[model samples]
Target chain A: MSDVATRLDVLKTYKLYVGGKFPRSESGRVYEVTDAKGEWLANAPLGTRKDTRDAVLAARAAVKGWAGTTAYNRGQVLYRVAEMLQGRREQFAAEVAVSEGIGPKKAAALVDAAIDRWVWYAGWTDKVAQIAGGANPVAGPYFNLSTPEPTGVVGIVAPQAGYGHSLLGLVSVIAPAIATGNTVVVAAAADAPLPALSLGEVLATSDVPGGVVNIISGRTADIAPTLASHQDVNALDLTGAIASDGPGAAPALEAAAADTLKRVVRPELDPFAQDWTNAPGTDRLLSFLETKTVWHPMGI
Target chain B: MSTVAANAPGVAGSGLQDVAASEASLRRFLHGLPGVDQVGLEARAATLGTRSIKTTAKAYAIDLAISMIDLTTLEGADTVGKVRALCAKGRTPDPTDPTTPRVAAICVYPDMVATAKDALRGTDIQVASVATAFPAGRAALPVKLADTADAVAAGADEIDMVIDRGAFLSGRYLDVFNEIVAVKEACKRPDGTSAHLKVIFETGELQTYDNVRRVSWLAMLAGADFIKTSTGKVAVNATPPVTLLMLEAVRDFRAQTGVQVGVKPAGGIKTTKDAMKYLVMVNETLGDDWLTPHWFRFGASSLLNDLLMQRQKLTTGRYSGPDYVTVD
Candidate 1:
């Protein structure tokens, strides 16, 4: 095992992640991750408590730069990811095919849908606030108005098994969250990590900064708790959590995130009745939200 | 806008107009005397195998007198030829049968009346003519009266005139009432016989059930022999709701004045089942008396085949082809 670890270390591209820079794991430990078919793939550094603490610090530090931008500018950046996804879709499909045991054609379709979802949410950023927000007529000497704002750094538990669907689902959640001006820390699809890592590569190449979206791939039980319990996380999207216990995992996630008064998105599964042809509106902007009410005195 | 005084009578006792007023009031009193709404019942014609159905009842009664008009369907024309064939099927009585119902009348347009009159000579069948811009009553009153007179003089047994909805909608109620009474006076039986007047209300143009009920009462009060729905021109001419409202109006009018009124629904009624459903509604709503030809009539272009098809279905266990049924 030590020899194998050594060999894996030789292939490691070690870097520090202080102030949004990737570095070697503080614990100096590496673990071999395999596909569903049990074929050895890349070795990912096993994240430690200190490494998680550093990630939370990076997430907290990067929130203002990510959230302070105007909605239109954010939309333009999100649309840029769509264009990038279009170009790298084949790579995504192949990676997904290996991770989820799906054929190339099906994986390709899923990749296309995921990329389209990015474009869909991209257009929604500037409009959802206007449509869902409106001026109110108050019966007093005050000017009343309401608007939706981002919920800040969101922690997402991406699906474990569906590589392409998980990517689509994660993009669906993340795009809506950040489109309205929120940063995110998503736990990559647990059983399928390569496609997400490839996505990280895309984000690295694209206009998105390092800490805007910080992805970690590890056993969900281990990595998700750090994200759920992290004091700095403003919201947590438990959409991808596997809650076989009884009701759902969202209430528990909500209970945990409540320690910091974080906005919690209860885990949910789509009823799957309507397809894209009938589906209306993007829910991404909904998951990451804060309704801040402001007031000003009117002249008597 | 000048509003007229409510409940005030118009020129009731002016010295110079007293004689004319008395005459008009007397004529109106006599005309308002209620008459039976029955036109003789006409048996619907259907062919069964080598033999034809000559009669299911005695003589078919129609709402329109239709006595003096000519039966012109005998022309070399195609559509007329079809109508002529429909009229002819009524002529072929069985050798052993002598009590077959006579074809009530061949209701035709004014131009075809002379011919229809000629073809139906010496027969009990009366020929009816649809006159006064029949489907749409948008023509001038004088022109309509002239048209009605001409058709009547040309041997039309009945004058089927339509009411002017423009006048009705504008609240010119008296004008519509006076116009129908004047047209009925002009329709004198040509051979000194009193030609019956059947007023066509064109019910589809009136938008509401309240309007239909009011119009039905107004037409009856103004001396109408019948109230028909539509020129068959509009999309909403003959619906069950409209018919139900009209039937109720007719029934109530009869109960009040002992004057049974007739109803004719025209347009878009395509099937025998549809016809039967209408019959069932009328029967249930207006009672067995309304099932007779005097009380009800269907103005349909395609109802015969459906009726025959349904009849065939009842007799035979399985359905047969439509081609086997005789077509007019």
Candidate 2:
């Protein structure tokens, strides 16, 4: 701990999330989870179905304020999260090390990499929409456009147990989704909830208002199907779901999501070393989209 | 009224001095018309021609000397077969060995120039080269002119040189004119079959239609044989609007001075539809004479396929052929 941090009085705050406010879980239960060094960090209150409903409501509330902001301003706000992450980087490194079971140095590097990725997407928030989406030259005088916009609330099954690599996979999905204006409900990586929960703390401090991202840590297979089936959830990012040519694994989720017509990104079949420096687009924005056309009278 | 001068610069010992004088005249002309938008001169800048024809038009004439040198796009055994089929069209039917229309000279890189010179030995077609770090002429002036001279010596019938856009954009217009003149002075033929020179304007990077017009006139006034559009390297090269404006300038220049300078639009041209559009534009705007190869040439690799496809459609009742026409 830094001498200043140790000298200053630190505060602890916890509550169930709803409508940009954190409240007690409606179930009135708490679960004790330990960090990597086996030290009890914070008692994360066990959320119920009612708690899930509240988080969705919170996500719905923040949507107007978030998506309504100018693209440049939104880009600036998202970029600020990168700045905040850099500022408290040591803390994230320590938490990631404990939660992810990696060395602190490696965790610190990953945190930096993840933060840098956010900065890249933040700059792109306004521009990618310009490059990939533009005014389509219609046959008539009617002006038509193809644009990338938020896909509303997303349900994500975060990577499962024993895969710390999947945490980054989860971050990749959430950052690109929300960066383009979608709010998310991420099921924390199973057996690796500490880092995910710590990430939630970072978000609470980072100007990412309540419910922009709601993290639920539990059995992914058990919790995911409910999130996927939720009629209110507009899309599903399934990087966490196991790959399957098999009958049940993806097909079940596929069928469940099909009821609601959720957007799905299958796991990479041949993953290369992540060239995070290469610009990410074409793949990200197309994942969630609704082509809306508006018509209005040109003359009286 | 003569396009070719009896005492052109590179004929004797007045190479550098004549180039400097030519550049001075061009600068004076550009400075004379402050409101002019585009200016270019078309001379066989590489060939030693005596007479310098000056025409003041609204648009610049940038004559580009481009020849297709790279054929690696035709790769693999299948590609080899396509090329051979194209070669089969090399002859016109002759009961007495009637010769076919030879390709407009086979342009190749310097190393392959000798091969082209050998292959096109007795043909009326002239071999051309894109010299001076073409498409982007940011190389040293000496190196660029030397590259032109070497290519010409190695059997290039014409030399196409690109002006440095950085120099042009940096407002060093005089230097660009001088560079073209210097390269033109370098393309001397000992046997007196001097090579032709085409100066490329790379009009796309010039931004404004007004600027394209001004550079067109400048190149033409300074003695451009043909003014061409684009090195085919930039994001915006040879759009219809830009070409339309330049073609108007070419027409006006020819009307004023009685000097017929060719116009070449060199990039992003694919498909017979595109070629026909250019042909239509030339015929409609610049008159029927400009439609011939003397005034027009499509600098493209894929244009042949499209032209062949259109030809087949015209001849055959239905479009019956393989996906790609046998290149011949």
Q: What is the DockQ of candidate 2?
A: 0.01
Residue B58 of model 1 has an lDDT of 11
What's the count of clashing pairs in each model shown? 25, 49
Report residue A80 deviation for candidate 1 (angstroms).
1.3
User: On a 0 to 100 scale, what is the lDDT of residue A63 in model 1?
Assistant: 74
Proportion of true contacts reproduced by candidate 1: 0.00
For model 1, the DockQ equals 0.01
TM-score of 1: 0.42
Question: Model 1 chain A — which ten-residue stretch has the worst lDDT?
Answer: A271-280
- C-alpha local distance difference test of each model: 0.62, 0.60
TM-score of each: 0.42, 0.41
Error of 1 at B287 (Å): 99
Candidate 1 CAPRI category: incorrect
Candidate achieving the largest lDDT: 1
